[model samples]
Target: MEEILGILTQLGLTEYESKAYISLVSLINAKADEISKNSGVPRSKIYPVLENLEKKDLIKIKQGRPLEYHVIAPEISLKNYEENIIHNIHILQQKLTRIYEEKLPHVNTPIITVEGLDKILKKEYEIIKQTKKILYLRIGFILPSEIENIKKALNKLINNGIKIRILAVEECEIDGKVVSIRDIFEDMDVEIKYKQLPSAQLIIRDYKEMFLVFAENSGMSISNSNMVGLFNTYSVIISNYLSAFNKQWSKL
Candidate 1:
């Protein structure tokens, strides 16, 4: 029953409301006091929980001697909740679009210089997080040691429905987590491209934005002076890079 409440919560039920509803189900018709006793919620809190459920049409409060509450069937309540959530999401999205239109600036160029490896990698994580379109990555030094953080970033990107294209550097052999990532990307809608590259840790987000990172040494250096630049524009140099990537993509 506890696990069932959790499932209901996942479907967008408030914890108290779900418990209240489930408690109501165990009775032919229940009052708030009975619901509180059965559900282990205090009587004081159960009334509000019942009221919320009643407002959603999940329960009917019969104004009888004791005022009994009856739960509507699961199908009805679930559908009602689903539709409510969908409607709420649409309304929220409309507000978000208006906010974005007002707040976001139109940019002229994409150019930034990154100094330290840490800063550059942090920038990489940010771009991945903010991606709303596509992400094309040509990774030559995707070391196994750094796989976890990279995977975490990519997972967040993929979850947001971003289109992902990845070209693994042939020299950067990997296993375990890397292989798991490959399998995930291949299976999901994310596109995977493999290549043998010499250098250049390249990330292109939505084609219009690009960044280049090259390691100064074996590990991502801790040099505070090292910086990674985020550009709102791409360069002609990126055209050459894309052209080569396309050629390599043809082989696979």
Candidate 2:
């Protein structure tokens, strides 16, 4: 059947090889000419297809006046193929991991300047999504429109077993219902503290990377304001900011 042939091809058999195998499975021990007639493969191609199948251990060749091809049991043949694939994947993982570890110490400091509120928020969302161990955030304020997205990102991080620590200036309310950002993370077991609004906005992840945004006019709506920020993994700068954040957190 076409479907069986398709499945056989997906399992690493060439189309001609799959057809020839299927034909030989039905015929048991058949000469190349008979296999070519049943499988619809050209007689010239059937010999090469059988040879390849024999090489792959999917078929056995019988010595006789005219050579005959017989299909190997699918269970044995397919299981061997699957095991080979998994073994190769494991070997690839080991080699790639070694290369990754070798280059990690030589990695350079990367400082990227992202402009515009939208661009900064986009980068923030990306960084938050990649959070692993810990996320430290100082929120002066977030736009009402962006709150939902930010909450979603935080929730995803929490689900991934990343611990979160947040410091904020004040609470926000929508439609007369108080929206406590901390309350959203209540069951997630994150630490939330309140403080007088800091002059700059900060987001640090895993104590290794940071983003700092400074606005020209503090009173202007954050969504519409022009903001400048650096997103970087410069270790010394990150360490200093982490220390400052810890100092500020201690006060709260």
Winning model by lDDT? 2
TM-scores, all models, native as reference: 0.47, 0.54
Off by over 4 Å in 2: 1-106, 171-188, 218-223
Give the alpha carbon lDDT tens digit for every residue of 22-48 in model 2. 898898778899999998999878888
RMSD of 1: 9.0
Evaluate all candidate structures by whole-model CA lDDT and list the values in order. Answer: 0.69, 0.77
Global local distance difference test of model 2: 0.77
The worst-scoring run of ten residues by lDDT in candidate 1 lies at 218-227
